[model samples]
Target chain A: MAPLGDNTNIAEEVMVAEAEKRPVSTIVIIIAMQTEALPLVAKFQLTEDLDSVFPKGVPWVRYHGLYKDLHINIIWPGKDGVLGVDSVGTISASLVTYASIQALQPDLIINAGTAGGFKAKGASIGDVFLACNVAFHDRRIPIPVFDQYGICAKQTFPTPNLLKEVQLKVGKLSTGDSLDMSPHDEAAIIANDATVKDMEGAAVAYVADLLSVPAIFIKAVTDIVDGDKPTAEEFLQNLVAVTAALDQSVTQIVDFISGKSISEL
Target chain B: MAPLGDNTNIAEEVMVAEAEKRPVSTIVIIIAMQTEALPLVAKFQLTEDLDSVFPKGVPWVRYHGLYKDLHINIIWPGKDGVLGVDSVGTISASLVTYASIQALQPDLIINAGTAGGFKAKGASIGDVFLACNVAFHDRRIPIPVFDQYGICAKQTFPTPNLLKEVQLKVGKLSTGDSLDMSPHDEAAIIANDATVKDMEGAAVAYVADLLSVPAIFIKAVTDIVDGDKPTAEEFLQNLVAVTAALDQSVTQIVDFISGKSISEL
Candidate 1:
């Protein structure tokens, strides 16, 4: 039997090649935070759809425009109107991704976000990673058989060519709604062999997989999980600089994705 | 301001009254487990829609039939094809609920399942509860203002008349995807004043709220979260008995809901 990674790569390659015969044209970039999204929105010259493409009363926002040969749409679950806080978590991310796919019918999805990295896994603040896989660390359904389902570990579209072309770090990304790691979460992350942790990536991956849309993840580290600093303090202090790094990485990705097919990536 | 209970009741009454002038004819029950759903399906004499009502290639199942004057439908995220495990988590719950609402167009949603209950909150195994509100305990955003958004607390439709008619415990429900509680999760649950904890209720509520569909949660305690017993062992030991209890309570509630308006409940 082939290794899990080998099986995953073979499956992804076949799925992507068979699913698309033309070069990827329309792309949806699902970003959870407004601060993390602003730089990319500006860089891509995306215009906000003030006409409200989503359902009425939802705080979801979509910015779209043509970038080179690709039609790029950046969708963010906008701030809660009453609380004035950006909606960031698995629920909001999955909903927005589902809605965006249904509404835009994009060829591919790119989940870009800021995350906490593990220094032990060779990560430092402001380093950008292209996730090879994504899984949930907090969804710990401990029942037999169901425990694996809780992880929901999914391989992102295998990008062997992209890995060769881009000089970005690649790692398994673990996602939970929490910003801070608990003992249980830490164990689960270690089990998943995750180097990066974020709130939205796996949820987006779930939606993308469900809808049979090829997806990739680009995560920028805002804080080091194993470092001796409070998560909230470190995250807030480094958010600006990390987001810029995320912007640069995502820009390069989008540039690479402009006229390439999924197989090429 | 009036007390939260009073305000919630008043607001719920107004929303229920305004949303539907006639009695509710269609109802969707979102249950996560087949063990919990089979009894209700039998009680309602629902026929499995083998023709596949949902999108193709998905493991979601829907059973529907008429119970008295009410069109009853039960939706569950079916077992994973590969692992043969029930897909139980916030992600699956949210997606299935969203899709069910879109497809069924039900007048109301009832999230019925087993949950771990706090003994400190006056709960015992097999004791059924009507969730007054639902929130997430594991989604710790930690950022100011956004922390509240992470909790995602939303009030369930107030069933004052039903509470008066039926003898059942009422409490707030805290949700996370984990079957076992982490210390951080326990803290968040306490902060939410939650007496019941489940994997799917808050997620169902989120989707229902987004779709403007009234949702009610009926939870039966399968394990004591704060008790001396291990959660998995206790949950497995109590599941069969508690599911029976859940079936009975849900039958009574459905009977009461039959031929009645949302405001009447």
Candidate 2:
């Protein structure tokens, strides 16, 4: 009885020690566009790594610093050296997210970006959203069993505390590589019950799931998908303002996440 | 003058030594389906790593062995543990390809799979093609410069010698996560001048280019995209026969690559 009591006491002490450590310490934010990254970089005061933490020749950029008690790293797939365009698609997002996870091994990943909102789903321009679920809108495999695999729907890490703390809209987010939705994409998106759409959310979610990393998506509305205006025109028109909204929401989120456990969130 | 001559001789000896090492010794073959991977695995006499070379909980399978003088690894994203369905889309393809490349640094990547061939481009059932160019048909980002980036068109490594040695067809290949082509995808495919379409070729190409590894694509026609028959029905009917053709073609190609360098090909 004495030895058993000592072992029990030792186990309790180990449990107490584990509980004392902060569950969420390091955070990595994956942003696809430089325009979307700049505001957050300024707000977080993240310094660019001039030596480049990523592989050579690729235009992937990393900015790092500490926010409060949390270590923060924001990574973006930089502009194409030849085409001079921001690398904004699922392919680049997946590659960068995979590389970031492999390199940083952060406790949490936050995919913050701009997306097109659906007015039918009660979304408006410049509204920030915490995505509850994410899936691809364009991968349409028509085979029997493979049809569902094409969608690859995934749920983001639950943050009920964060949701209650912040007054942000919550919705299902659909992802596709296309900026403009085709008829097929519309049908798929409707089936997905998605309120917001972006190019990289589901891809990032897929990579995160593959690596067993918990991820949260915060998307700001840049355009109304079902609206009358052209997608490209509306996106460009609202990018700057929407990015500001996203930056503010992300800042609040990171502040809340600091010194808190994943279970607490 | 004597010292200069000796230095020249040493330089020539170093060049000869470099040339003597087999340049194309390690090869990775990425197949998306089990039915497509079985034949190649059997032909190469590869043993399945039941212990699993991939990360735990992922269904990615690796079959590896020595084929003649080359080290060949055939990787397939296996069936979903819960859903019991083959993981078959760009998301799974990209993640598995990235993981495979990181784990096994290979000299070449050969994406071998079944594809929907276009009758308008003179593709017939069971026709094997070595893709000359690879691009995406469904990633339709409509922004000004991003319109081109969405397609992400890339050229495959040239194999003029192999082309001369083999009698397989050669054409442009377009990739999308969708098995069924949308109208927008069709338009993009036409613009890509694609003769064949699959779900993973361009994704594999993207990762390969990011890692600076040379890649080649081998596709066998399983269905005619523009034909009168239904895609699913036709694809099901031809899958077995097409796999045979793909196996034969891949075997011949591997045999050809056994003793040659990338420069020689």
Candidates' C-alpha lDDT: 0.87, 0.85
Segments in model 1 whose C-alpha atoms lie over 4 Å from true places:
A1-18, B1-17, B51-53
**Candidate 1 residue-wise lDDT, A139-258, digit = tens:** 887788888888989888888877887779999999999998989999999999999999999999887776678889999999999999999999999999999989998888888877
Interface RMSD (Å) of candidate 2: 11.0
Chain A TM-score values for every predicted structure, listed in order: 0.93, 0.92
Clashing pairs in 1: none
Candidate 2 lDDT, tens digit per residue, A1-265? 0011212366654653464355688898999999999988988899998987676446788999988898899999988654778888888888888888888877788999999999999999999999999999898877876787778787788999899998799999999999999999999999999999999999888777766667899999999999999999999999998999999999999989888986678
How many angstroms is residue A173 displaced in model 1 relative to the true structure, after the best TM-score fit? 0.8
DockQ, per model, reads 0.50, 0.37
- How much is B197 displaced in model 2, in angstroms? 0.6
Given candidate 2, what's the lDDT at residue B82?
43
